[model samples]
Target: MNTHAQSPDKLAEKILRGVGGPENIESLTHCATRLRFQLHDGGKADQAALDALDGVMGTVPQSGDRLQIVVGGGVANVYSDIMSLPAMRGSGARPPSDAEVKAAMRAKSRGRFAWLDNFFEYLSDSFRPLMGVLLGASLIIAITSVLEAFGLIDTRATDKSSTWVFVDAMWRSVLFFLPIMVAYNASKKLRVDPWLGAAVMAAMMTPNYMSMLGSSSEVPGVSCTTNETLGSEQCVAKVFGLTMQLNDYGGQVFVPLAMVALLALLYRGLQRLIPENVQLVFVPFFSMLIMIPITAFLIGPMGIWAGNGLGSGLAWLNSNAPIVFAILIPMLYPFLVPLGLHWPLNALMLQNISTIGDDFIQGPMGAWNFACFGATAGVLLLSIRHREKEMRQTATGALAAGLFGGVSEPSLYGIHLRFKRIYPRMLVGCLVGGVIVGLLGGVDTEVFAFTSLLTIPVFSPMVTYGIAITAAFFTAMVLVYFSDYRSPEERAQANAERDADERAARDDSAAADVREPLAVGAATAAVGGSGASAGSPVAAGAPAPGEGIVLAAPVAGRVIGLDEVADPFFASRVLGEGVGIEPANGHVVSPVDGELVTAAVTGHSFGIRTKDGVQVLVHIGLDTVQMNGEGFDVRVEPGQQVFVGDLLAEVDLDAVHAAQHSTITLMTVTNTAYLASVEAHTGQDVTVGAPVVIVRR
Candidate 1:
C-alpha cells in the first residue's frame, strides 16, 4: 500500500470499516498502542481477516493503540495507504456532481490566501518531530545523574579517577551545545541558512569581558592576629589613582543572558550599517568593541548575579525541603519532554549532581522513568489476548521499546497521542509510582549504562528502585484492566454489518453477468455517442473500451472478491461479467450508467440496467448488509434514475472503511452470456468514477 498518497480521513474510514464500520465502534482512542476503539461487540471483529490485510502487522484486543496493532515501524505508511483509499474519503467523500466539482474548482481558484494558511500549518506540523530530539538529549542527562549518584566514580576528579568526568562532559555537551541543534532544525523549517543560526549560537557560547570582571580580586578581612593594615591606617585601594579603602570584587562574574541578546542586536545593526563590501570585517570589529564593554559593565554583571541568585535559591530549596524537591522533579519531568524547555534546568541539575556527589533532582526523575515503564507494561499485558493482529503487533513493538530501549517516541507519537482516553490511567500510574519512590527515599546516585530492559538488572540492588518499579507496574495494570473496553454487543453488530456488506458485494458480482458494454469507437467518435454527448468524461481523452483497456480502481482500497458468473446458452458468453469490487468501505459511485436501472432491495447494491440490456450491478462495498443501509443515501431511484454522471448514492466513507471492507466500486455486466468477448482493464491505477471495461458482441 502506498501510504504517502492517502488522506487522513480516508485512512480513518478504512480502519473503521475493518473493525466492522462505525456501528461496531462504540468509541475510539489512540495511545502508545493501536487505535483503542471501544467496540459495541467483539464478535464483529475478524481478527484473522484484518491481520491478513496488506500493511497490517498484527492486532491485539487490549493495549497499546488499545486495539494494539504492530503496523511495523512504518505503521504510518500503512495509515497513509488506508487514508488514500477512496472509500475512506471522510466527510469530503461525496460523489460530487459535475456541477459540484466545477464549483469547487472555482472556489479553490478564488482563494489565493490559502498559501499563507498552508505555510503555517506546515510549520506547526513540522514541530512535532523535534520533540524526540530534545527528549532524547534530556534523557541522556537524566541517565548521567543516575550514574553519578551510585558513587561508582569520584565526581570532582577530572582525571581517570572519576567516571563522572566523562559523564559531566557528556552532559555539558548536550546542554551547552543545544542551541546549535535547535537552530539547525529551525533554519531548516524556515528554509534559511542553518550555519548562520549556528554562528549566532556560537556567539552565545563565547566568553565575554563580564566574565573577566567577575574574576577580580576580593577584599582581605582582618583576623585576630593580623591587624597589619588597620594599625598603620594605610589600608588604601587605588581606583584611577585616587586612594581609598576598596572593597575588592574578584573572580568570574556572571554575565546576563541579555548581554548575549544585546550583542546579537548590535551585531545585526552593525551589519546593516556597514557597506556590503566591507561589512564582514568592519561589522564584527565595531560590534565587538561597542557591545563587549556595555555587556561587561552592565548586562554581563546583572545576568551573572541573577543566575547566581537563581542557583542559590534552588540550592536552598534542595537543602531545606528535600521531600518537596524530590516530588516536584519527577512530577514535572514528563511535561518538559513534550515541550523543548527542560534542557537548561536538567543540565544544571546534572552538573549539581556531579559536582556535589549528590543530586536530589536525578533521584526523583528515576521515579518518572519507572512509571513510564510500568504504563507500557500494563498496555502490553492487556494486549496479550487481543483479537486484532495489527493491534497486537503494535503493542508488542511499543511495549518492547518502553521496557528495554527507554525510547517512548513510538508509543507516545504513534499511540498515546491518539488514545487520549488512556492518558489518565498512565498518569495515575506514574503518580503512584513516583509517590511511592519519593516516600521510600529512593536514591538514584548513578546513571544507568543504557536505557533498556537490560539496565533494569543494574538498578535491582536499590530497594527504592525495586519498590517504585513494582508500584508503577501494578498501578498501570489495574487501571488498564478495570477500564471499560469495547462492549460485546457492539462487536456483534459490526460483525453483522460486515457480513451483510460481503453478501451484497457477492450479489452485485452475480448481477454483473447482465451488464452491457459501452459502445466502442474512436475517442472523438465516442464523444458523439449519447453516453458522452452530455459532455466529455471528467478525464477527457481516456482510452476507449476496445483498445486493451486497463481498469484502475475508482477508489483506494483492497481488491475484494473478484469473480465471474456461470452462464451457458448465449453466443455472447465470451463477454464475461466484469469484476466485482468492494471499495474499502460502503462508499459507491456510478461506474457507468447508459440509463437508469434498478436500485437493489438490500439498498447495499445498485443495478444500472443499462439501455443496451447489459445490466451493471455495483455493490457499494463488501459486507455492508448488516448496516441495513443506515449510512447510504440514495440520490437516484430505480427506473426514474439517471445518466452515468448522476449521483446515485452517497455512502458514508468513514463508516464503511471502519467496517474493514474495501470500498471499491464494482462494475459487473449481469448478462455476460450475451457478449462475444470481455477483457480486463490493463492499467495499475485507474482513476475512480472512470470507465473500466469494454464488451464485444
Candidate 2:
C-alpha cells in the first residue's frame, strides 16, 4: 500500500491506475497542492487504493464526476510525471484555464441542498457578466439626472433637441436591448447556443413587431385593449388563425431567464433525436422554428405576467405598509446579495420602472448599500489603528468601490464574510436608515441607477435620501469600529501575526543582500506548509545540525499518531506528518519554539514556523469552525515568537461536546514532505509541553 518505495514514474502509474487508468481520466490539471481531474466515470476510481498509495496524501471525490488528489507541494512535478507516462501521453488533455478551474471548484463546493444551490448559481451566472455594461449605463443616467437637477435640459418635454435625443439613446441602448443580452447570457449558462436564444428575444423587439402597435386599429388581425387596474394598453394579434399576445419585449429580463431554461431542455432533447452529421443544421433550423412561436404566443405573456405579478405584490406592500416595506427591502438584501437572490429583486426594479414609470425599491435599498460601505469603512479605521496592512488595503478598495460604484460584493466577500461580527452591526444600520426613509415618505427614481453617491440626484426628494443614507453609513461605521470586527483574542493574534510577518520581511530583505538567492522551491515552499518562508538560514538563527526539533504536547492529553486522528485530511498527512491528542484539559500552548504564522479567529487552529524551518500546526477540536469561537478563548497573537509551553488558547471542552465536535487537539508538521523525516511519539498520557513529535532535517 505504501508506494513511497516506488519511483516517481511508478507512483504516477499507480495513481493513474487507481483513478481507473488513462481512459477514465477525461482531463487532468494540478494546482499548487492537488491534482484536479475531470473523470469520465468517477465511480470507477478506486478510493481505497488511492488512499493507500504512497505518494498521494488523500483523494476527494467531488460532485459532477470530478476528483482531486492531494499530492502536497510536489503536485506540479507529479502532474508532469503522470502526463509523461506512455499510456497517458496520447490521452492527456490541455490544462484548464484558471477561470475554468475556479468555476469547477465552485461547482464542487455546492451546498447541502443541491436544488437551492443550483438555483442561485444559475441566477448569479446569468447576471454577473452583464454588470459592467449595466454600471456604465447607470452612470450615464446618473449624469443625465445631474444635468436635469441643474435645469440643463427638459428630457420629458417630447420636443427634445437632437443633442438631448442622442444623449438619451446613449443610455437607452443598454436598457432597451437588455432582453437580448439576458437571453444570450442565460443560454450560455444553460449550455445552449447563445445566438439562438438571442434571436428568439430579438424577434419580438424587431420593427415588424413594433409596427403592429401603431396599426392595431387599422389592421384586421390586430386588436388593443386597456388594462383598467395598471392603466396600460395590452394588444393581441392573430397569427396563422391563432390569437397571440403582443407585448413590448424591451427591458424584460424574466422572459429570457424563463425561456432559456425551457430551451436547454428542448435543445438537448433535439440533439438526442437528431443524427450527429446533420444535427447542426437541423438543430438550429428546428429550434428557431419551434421556439419563436412558442415564445411569442405563450412564454412572452407568461413572463410578463410573472414579472408584473411580483411587482404588483411589492407595490401593494409599499403602498399599504410603507414602513414595513421600506425596512423589509433593506433587511432582505443583505441575505439575498451573498446568495445572488438579489438579482430577482433587481429585475423587479427594472420592470417597475418600465411599467409604472418609476421604481420605489432603490430608495430603501440604499440603506443596505450604505450600511455595507460603512462596515468596510469601520474595518479600514481599525486596520489603520492596529497597523494591519492587508486589512487596510482590502477595506480601502472595498469602501471605494461601494461608495463610488455601489458594489457591495468586495466588502461582503473580502471582509464581512471572513469575520463573523460585522453582519449584525451592519443590519442595525440598515434598520435605522430604512425607518428614516419610511418616515420621510420614501424616495423614487425614474431611471434604473445603482445606489451610489454619483447617482443620488436620480432619486426624488434628494434631501430625504441623503439624510437616511448618511445616518445608515455612520451608524454602521460607529458600531463596527467601536466593538471591533474580531474578538479580543482574535485581534491580539492578528496583530501578533502582522508583527511577525513584518519582521520576517525585514529579515528576508537583510538576508537577501548577503546570501545567494535561495531556490524558488526553498523560498516559497514549506515553512507553515502555507508557502510562508522558512525564516532565517541555519547559520543566522536555526537550531544547529543533529539537534533536531522537538514538538511538545500543546495540551494535557493522551497522545496518538496522526493515523488515529478523526479527520481524513489529517490522517492522510496531506497537511504534513504529526500527532493528534485527545485533550485531558482545555489549556493549549505552543508546541515548538517558533514564530506564530496563523492564529485562526475562530480559535480552532494555529500555524507556527520555527527558525530552523520546522513548521507545526496546532488544531483544536474537529469541525470547531462551525462553532464560531463560542467555546475557545484564544490568547496569543500570530508572529509572536514562542517557546514550547507558551499559552496559546483556552478551550471549553464541554462546549465542544455540546457543539457535537471531537475534542482532539492535533499538532502536525505541515511541511513534512520538505523535511528529511517527521516521527510521532504516541500511546501515552502527557502533560502540556511533553515531547509528542520529533522532526529531523
Candidate 3:
C-alpha cells in the first residue's frame, strides 16, 4: 500500500535481526508463501518470539533445509527485511553500500526487452494463486461432460435450457476473462500503466472481434477489389485491393503491443518538431490518426497472424507426434508452472480446441496432465516420512492440490524445489505415465475448464487413463522413496553446528549474569583506556609492555606466524613480520593492528601497519593474485584503522577449492627488520585477537 520504494538492504537487515540473527540460521531460501530457513538449533530459534514480531505470519519446521515462516502477502517485504540485517550480511547477502545494493537490485529489475519475460514470470508467480479459479471452472465443465456422456445432461434439449446455458456461459467467461487476470499481473511486473494494458487486453476480448476470429472467415462484403473493377463498378470505391479479415490477436503475442509502443515513441519524437504552443493540441490529434489506422490494418493483422501461427504450430506438433507432448508436457509443466508460462500455452491450446475441435490440448497435453498428477502424488507420499512437522503439513497440502485439485504449485514449490533431487524422479514418473496414456489412446474429450485434480474424471473412459495416472503416481513415490537424495554428511554437519551454537548461547547467557560488572569495566577500559591509572598491573591477561600492542588476527583461524610460508615468495621473511592464519583450510585473515593503507589492485593482497609502527603485508595465497580477488570479501575501507582482531576481509575457501587452487594465508612485515624480534603464539587453531605476534622496540 505504501507505494514508496524501500531500500532492500535495510529491509533485509531488519528481518535478519528479528529472526535471531545470522548465527541462528543454518541456511535460508524463499518461496511465494514464506521465507524457509534451516536453523542451527531449533531450541535457540524462539519461534514464538519470532511470531510475536511484526511482519511474520507463522513459523514451522518443514524439512531438511526447510523452515517455513509465513509472512502473508508481503513475503517479499519480509524477505527484504531479512536480507538487510547486519547479522545476515554473510558472503551471500549483498551489502548496503550504494554500489553493491544498486548492482543487486538491477539484477531483479525489469529489462528493456522484458515484455515477454514479465509475461512469463507473472504467469508463473500467479499460477498457484489462480488455481482456485481455474479448478472451479474446470470441475464444472468436467461434471457437465460426465453427465452428457451418461445421457443425464441432454445437450440438444439443454442448449435452450437456462441451467445448461448458465454452465456454458460460466465456462466461456473463465476462459475469455483469463487474459484480464494475466494483464493485471503483467502490468504490475512491467511497471506499465495498468489501465492502459487492461484496456488493450479488453479490446482483444470483445465479443464481435473474438467471434470473427473464431469463425476464421472474412468479413462480409470486404473482399479484394481490382482497380479496373472498382473504376467500372456501380459505386466507385475509394479503398482498393483490401480484404477485411477477423482479428486474431487475442493471446500473449508481443508484436501488436510492440507496434503500439513504437508508435508512441514516434509520436513523442514528432512532438519535438511541432511549434511549442500548438504541440499539445496537435500531437494527440495527429499521432492517433497515424497510429490507429496503421495499427488496425497492418500491425494488428500481423500480430493476429503471429498468434495464430504459434497456435497452429503447437497443434501440428501435438497432432503429428502426440507422444512427444505426452513426454514433454508433464516434464516441463512443473518447471514452467512455477514461472507462469505454462498457462498461456494452455489458454492458447484451449482456445484452439474450442475453435477447431482437434487441437493439441486434447491430444498430447491430456497425457501430460495425468503425468503431473503422478508427480504430485509422489511428492506427497515421500513427505510422509519427513522429520520436520511443518514440512509434513506443507507436503499434505501439496498432495491434496495434486491429487484432487490438479494444482501443481504446492508440489512444485513446497516439495520438488525443496527436495531438488526429487525433480528428476518426478520427471521420470510423468514420462512413464505419459507413455502409458499415449499407448491407451487417451483423449481429452473436454477442454480443461478448471485447474483441479477433480476435473481429471472428465477425461475418463479413455482406455488406460486410470491406469496411467495410477502408475505415474506410484512410480514417482517409489522413486522418491528409494533414492538417496539428501546427503547424510551435510545433515550431520548441520546438526553438529546447531548443537555447538546452542552450547555457546547457553554459555554466554550464564556468563552474562556473573560477568556483567567485569564486562562493563573492560568495555570502559577498551574505549577510555583510563583504567591504567588504577594501578592494577594493566590487569590480568592485559597487554604487557613489549606486547602493549596486541596484533589481532584479521581473520578467524589457527594462528600461525610468517615463518610458516614455505613458498619462495615469503621464505626469507623475518621477525616483526605480519602474521596470517588459515581460516578454514585456505581463507586468509588480516594480521595486524593498523589502518588499511592500501588494497592491492588485484585485491589478493592488502597492507596493514601495526599500532606500534610495523607495516605488514598479508597475502591470502600464493598465485592467488591470479584469482583477481574473486574469493575475497573486503570489509575495511581505505584509511579505516582496525583493532588487532577486527575482521578486515573474508576469503572464500569454497571458491578457492572450486578454482582448484590452494589457499595459504601469509602475514609478512614489509618493514619487519625495524622490530627487535617477533614471537609466534604457542597454541594451534588460534582465533582472531589471540596474541599471534609480540613486537618489541
- Candidate whose lDDT is highest: 2
Task: Give TM-scores for every candidate, taking all chains together and pairing residue i with residue i.
Answer: 0.37, 0.64, 0.45
* Model 3 per-residue lDDT tens digits across residues 453-548: 444555655445666666667777777667723333223222323332343445466644332222211111101100000001111132354554
| RMSD per model, one decimal | 19.6, 8.4, 16.1
Q: Point out the higher-scoring one by TM-score: 2 or 3.
A: 2
What overall lDDT, based on C-alpha atoms, would model 2 receive against the true structure?
Answer: 0.74
Among all candidates shown, the one with the greatest TM-score: 2
lDDT score for candidate 3 against the true structure? 0.49
For each candidate, the alpha-carbon lDDT, in order, equals 0.45, 0.74, 0.49
Better candidate by TM-score, 1 or 2 = 2
The true-versus-predicted C-alpha distance at residue 51 of model 3, in Å, is 28
Sort the predicted structures by TM-score, highest score first.
2, 3, 1
Candidate 1 deviates by what RMSD? 19.6
